[model samples]
Target: MQQLLLQMLDGTVTSLKVFVLTLIFSLPLGFIVAKGRMSRNFLLRGIVNLYIQIMRGTPLILQLIFVYFAPYYVIGFSYDRFTAVIVAFVLNYSAYFAEIYRSGLQSIEKGQYEACKVLGFSKTHTFFFIILPQVVKRILPSLGNEVVTLVKDTALAQTIGVSELFRVAQNAASRMFSTMPIFVAGVFYFIMNYIVSKMFDFFEKKLSYYR
Candidate 1:
């Protein structure tokens, strides 16, 4: 049991690494994608929209497999498994997050923009100081849901052989020929998601002042 716990702990670390790195890259990339989706340039908007559609329409496991193998198949170069997993996860999730951000950005009334104009605020100032705060408040719930889903989705790294938590559990279960290791991994997942939920709840309460 102790050995199983230790192995799980190591695997959990890998899972957490994937989760954190995905968020770190995806959040900012999502914003960029959102901007492109909303661009005045028709060609840019079309390209971004197409990218988002492809990402959101496809299965993440398929994306992971493609990311892991495409380099070797197309160009005769190989990617490290973890690198491939992170790239796949980031690109996939950024599309969802981009839509979330786009919705929040569009939700702000024209009056707010007019007010910023009346105040002689620069575009940068209006966005960063006046608009973004409200958008963040509005999008927090949706963002939280995505974040929670990301916790579970990290397991998909196993499809590319990244040895994340679920992969580790599968190996252990196969070795022992029992389901106990899988159940233990479930506990780990539940605990992680519980913490994420509580953290989001706390943020929601703190931001209730926006209401």
Candidate 2:
């Protein structure tokens, strides 16, 4: 059992890496996406819309396989498995996060923009200082839900053979001919999700002052 735990722990590191890297890249990319989605240029908006549609429409496992294999199939090249997993996860979640941000962005009233203008706030200042904080508060719950889903979605990295936690558990379970390792993995996931939930709740309370 101790050895099994050590193996699982190693796998947890990989899973955690995927989770952290995806969020780091995806959150910023999602903001870019939201901006483009609301762009004045028709062509840019169309392209971003198409990307969001494709990413949100497909199953993540399929995206993982495509990301891993497309380079080899189309360009006669391929990177490492982990890179593919990260790319796929980042792109997929970025689209969802973009929509979440869009909804929050849209929810802000025109009066706020006018008020900021009267206060001599630059557009960037208005967005960053006044508009964005409120948007963050409004979107925290939806963002938290997506974040919890991301915890589970990291398992899809295994579809591209990245050996994340679920993959490690499957290997251990098959070797031992027992489901114990699998169940233990579920505990690991639950703990992660619980922590995420608590963190979001804390953030929500911190921003409750906005209301």
Q: Provide the TM-score for each candidate, comma-separated.
A: 0.98, 0.98
- Residue-level lDDT of model 2, residues 1-211, one tens digit each, is 9999999999999999999999999999999999999999999999999999999888989999999999899999989999999999999999999999999999999999999999899999999999999999999999999999999999888887889899999999999999999999999999999999999999999988747
Q: In angstroms, give how far residue 5 of model 1 lies from its true place.
A: 0.4
lDDT score at residue 176, model 2, on the 0-100 scale: 95
lDDT of 1: 0.95
Residue-level lDDT for 172 in candidate 1: 97
Span of ten consecutive residues with least summed lDDT in model 2:
202-211
Kindly list the per-residue Cα lDDT of model 1 for residues 113-196, writing each as its tens digit: 999999899999999998999999999999999999999999998887889899889999999999999999999999999999
Clashing pairs in 2: none
